[model samples]
Target chain A: MFCFIALLVFSVLGIFSATHRKFAKEAFDCVFRRITFRPCNTGFREKVRGIILVKLMKRSSFFAKVFNKYFELIAWIFFVLMIVSTFYVGRGAYNFYLYGNCNGVNEEGFCLFDPTGENNKISPVAPTCGLDTPTVDDLSLANTDLDKFFFIDNNSEDTVVFIGCYVCDFTRKAFPDIEKLLEKKKPNFYFGHLPVKHGSDFISSYDYCAREDTSGDYWKFVELMFTSDIENINDQNYLQEVVDKAGYDKSKIDECLADPETLASIEQNIFNIGNTNIYGTPLVFVNNKAIVGPKPYRVYKGFLK
Target chain B: MNIKKLRKDFYFLQKKNYIYFDNACNSLRPDCVVEKINEYYKEYPVCAGRSNYALAEKLTTDLLGVRKNIAKFISAKEDEIIFTKNTTESINLLANSLDLKEGDIVLTTDKEHNSNLIPWIKLKSKGVIHKTINSNPDNTFNIERLSKVLCPEVKLLALGMSSNLDGVSIPAKEIIDLAHKNGSLVLLDAAQSAISEKIDVKYLDVDFLAFSGHKILGPSGTGVLFGKKDLLEKLGSFLVGGSTVHSSSYDDFELADIPERFEAGLQNFSGILGLGEAIKYLEKIGLKNIQKQKLVLNEYLSNELLKIDKLHIIGPEEASRRSGIVSFYIDDIDSHQLSIMLDRSAGIMTRSGQHCVHSWFKSREVASSLRVSMSFYNTLDEVKKFVDELNNIIKILR
Candidate 1:
């Protein structure tokens, strides 16, 4: 049992040290003999036990005596600990590979693979929005009304709902990757605008008005919004210029933006987006699986199949 | 002798704060011996008898001088000294070269080291008989038992001059005289005894004697086999190679002189030079002084060790009888564990186990014992620290 633990420890240490390599070889031999149901004739266990006892005997004889008496029990305990820790480490590696975070999807807990929680980072929603703090388990798209949102139906069963703020930095950072994934996968994609930053709510309303007009290419207009300068998006004249440049009727968009029904529709859209329990922008639901933050393009594409 | 000043001569003693008590295993080489060995590698490093260049001639002269010096050290003729790898090889050479027929007996004491015991045991394949003379109850040599075993069929009496297990030396002169009276030759295994006991081969009239260089502050892989001139002439060469012969034809060859005929091929020049320097160093220190110093240290160590309960000494009760060694074991504690702990905790080195006399321990039904064999350079202070550390270990282990 002690040889088993020695093999694990010394094999790892053997990589960087020549001295430990000898001990590692001895331990491997001992372990091989034990697994084959033969007695450990190498004396490796006794050698290691004697070394430990000698070191312990230097400090206290009573401790050495106790240690010598219960060495097998102690080795068993350490062996169990080694096995348990190895299992957890293996599980963590598996979760990291699948979810891009060691703690699982949308979890904000510290992960060794992503030490700064960079994969789970988000732009926080303003407190004035009157929303509860979001939990990963609570952020599900089951109760959300998808019909109210602007969506592109590729006639495929797969769907991706991307919620982002036009002015948020993280949302802007995620825009290119998500845009590339959408073009490549061609899923039934939906875009929801949540203005988490100050002075960004008006642009969401404008976006809603522009998308409601059937004569305009809304996706081109939304792409222009994400790619354009923040100052250009914030300028009302520049927004109209972008709207006209994309070949939409500026008067029709303006008339729709002033209508009370448009306001009611935008509020309904916000209520529907809130059903997904989103507390931050750049949250995307791919096939009803909610992922927070701007993950790499591969992570967003992983859910397509 | 100034023990402190003598300790300074040894390089290992100066480099570390260690209590070395394993002198019976191998004594630490002094600076002069190391320098002498280095001189061979640095100056004239070539074959002695074969090469005729200036450097080789000088090396031949230097090697011959070393042989002469070593011969003087043991009071034997220069031509009688044969160089070997160690005492084991030296004894094996005698065992193989001696003219022994089937049914002839080789007698040895019960406590002979494996080096001396195994060679005789190996002769059983050639139909040569091997016998043992039992020791006294306290592990001392029994002269009465030897008289009974000294029969007409006993061709040789092979014995250890001193036992490495407990440091007990036998009555070599009396045994040799008794064996000679019964028409048997005597061979002494002086691997342990040569360090402290003075050996005058001519005076003792011993037929053969063997000792290793490493036991006497000399370099390892060097040993000497000394025999009477006529006796060495009667023995055949065990190993024959380039230098063992003067000239050879297709069918027959003539062997070289006594020492060169026995020392086949190229020899360990550095080891031989270093051993010569060691002999010179020992001559200056005097074997009597070394023995006296060892007795003082061993007596103190034995008395201190005996104070502990359940601790039993291996040899006779008197420290004088055991030379410089104090071999002891506690009933419950393992000697190897104690030896390791002593070294780790206190920087004290000791020998644990059978000390290569496994047959003796097996006969006595004892597992092992911790042996502390001191040298002249060992101080009383070091022995005191060893005792203190040992007591600490015993207390903790118990």
Candidate 2:
């Protein structure tokens, strides 16, 4: 929905290689030091030239007073700006805290105060306020006008899972067309490389289900896609289409699929939220506002001021 | 060594107004190298190996001639030399091709450039154990320290001919002999030292040597990998493509002979021709005389820098161990900031940061430093002017 073409600027040209915490600090430090260190440090003759000229003019006291006043004024200006900038950053962070959604999934595929179940009835779990994830029973009302089945990624913090494989069949990349597009849409996602532990079987693949899921707050999206098709698509419609086409045989995959591994992974993902001061999904923050995938250059430009 | 011509080249550099201290990074292509490339591009630019046409044959012959020239230059056979993109690729080729089994320990120094270090350490994930020998605080090699680290598990000892961070030339002859006595093959990264100094691989008895032509007044995108004939024969090719294979089918393939097997796809023909010209130029000037000039200029710079207060040189004071590079830094100012100031204000170029020897800098516990390197073309006047510039920059910085 965002400017897809314009965001390509960041995907292709931006310095993605520089992302680690240490390097990030070093980058800021490098910029700060560079700006602070230039200009006046030109030449020794240039250095003494002004001072000697001032002294020879018999206005050394006036020159010294001017220099002191100039420095003091500049110092106050930078200090005030820095304080304002810090408070602005603090406010943005406060908003992130207030708006963050770290609750259990609902039928709407979002964490709401009260969520609904398949029969349009209230959820059985009477969730507590702020303490536990809210259920459908706790709902004040339903906003049916909002797009149903739409993924409301209104939550600012999104997590991405990065998967890297060496001998991977990089062939099937274009097949997961929908997932690929989604991955492209939101660059601010996580896909922790599992090192190809999963095999092409239900059990082996589901083993990832049991693997410890860290947090529910961040967007648990996987950017890495492959062309391994589990279902035969005569019409070639992926996900629900593949299941819909399977008909009676869909039971083996869709209905009977209470995959222990998946449940385990959800448990794992949900288990450690807010534990060990774990900062949920990485924020691919551009100019402070949260954006996923490559937001159009205009989205980035809009926030600059 | 014809100081007048060298000065002319230096003036040619000054006319462009690029102080170009990135000599350690990669030296600028000399006029002769540029002409050699022009001759290849203008006269005979054709794809090699597949064709027996006149131009193709000339390209093939010229490329092979470069191989032979490089082999002769380093006392290697033409068949034992494999051309690659740069020093990193050359060492990576060696790393991938070498018969490294699990449990084989790679003995190397902490001061090694990443090009020599990464490829070997990468083998660690494949279950190969890597053991590092410590470099002295002054970036000098200690024979006893290396001897203690060399064990039966040490199948190979990789070394850099000169430390890129500090420009200290290793006692490779002695190091190679020590490794051989322990029954280990040695690979030397001569990317930094090869152009500035004489390299007699046979005399030094090095099992393998890799170098970049760009560092030696040649064009970029050309590197040479040389190994002992027997060792080269034993190693397998990592990359498989058009020229590298002898025979191929849908399912199976046979690799080509030694050097061809290693060199896959289209060759950088122009780069090699230019590299050959660079070698021809160096030979004309003579490595001994070139080495002498660089050392004189280096020593002058190092001595002058020593005169400045708070300016600490990174390497040893001993002239014999150090090459033409001098890495130094001062109090308060970061090396990155200093390098920028030097380039922007004085038009004096220099390299700063870790110099791709993070482990070396980390091991020494010194943060980061600025580097000013010299080649045969650099002179006493440049050194003096550099000192004057430093004095000015430092005064303002302080």
Q: Per-residue lDDT for B1-398 in model 1, tens only?
A: 99999998988999988889999999999999999989999987788878889999998899899999989999998999999999999999999999998999999999889999999999999999999999999999999989987899999999999999899999999998999999999999999999889999988999999999999999999999999999999998899987899899999999998978999878999999999999999999999999999999999999998899999999898999999998998888778777877888788999888888889888988778899999999999999999998888777767
Candidate 2: count the clashes.
Answer: 24
Q: Which tens-of-lDDT digit does each residue in B1-398 have in candidate 2?
A: 77766656532574765566778998877787888899988998889889989999888888888888888888878888888899999999989999989999998888888999999999987789888888777768888999888888899999888888888877899999989999999999999988867888889999999999889888899999988888988997798898988899999998888888888888898998999998888888888887787789887888888888888888897554577788887766567656765666556788877888888777667677889888877767777777876665555545
The per-residue C-alpha lDDT of model 1 at residue B168 equals 94
TM-score of each: 0.82, 0.60
True contacts kept of 1: 0.50
**Candidates, DockQ:** 0.38, 0.01
* Alpha-carbon shift of residue A235 in model 1 (angstroms): 13
Q: Model 1 Cα displacement at B38 (Å)?
A: 2.4
Q: Please provide, for model 2 over A199-264, each residue's C-alpha lDDT reduced to its tens digit, 9 standing for 90 to 100.
A: 333332222321222221112222212332333311223433423322323334443346554545
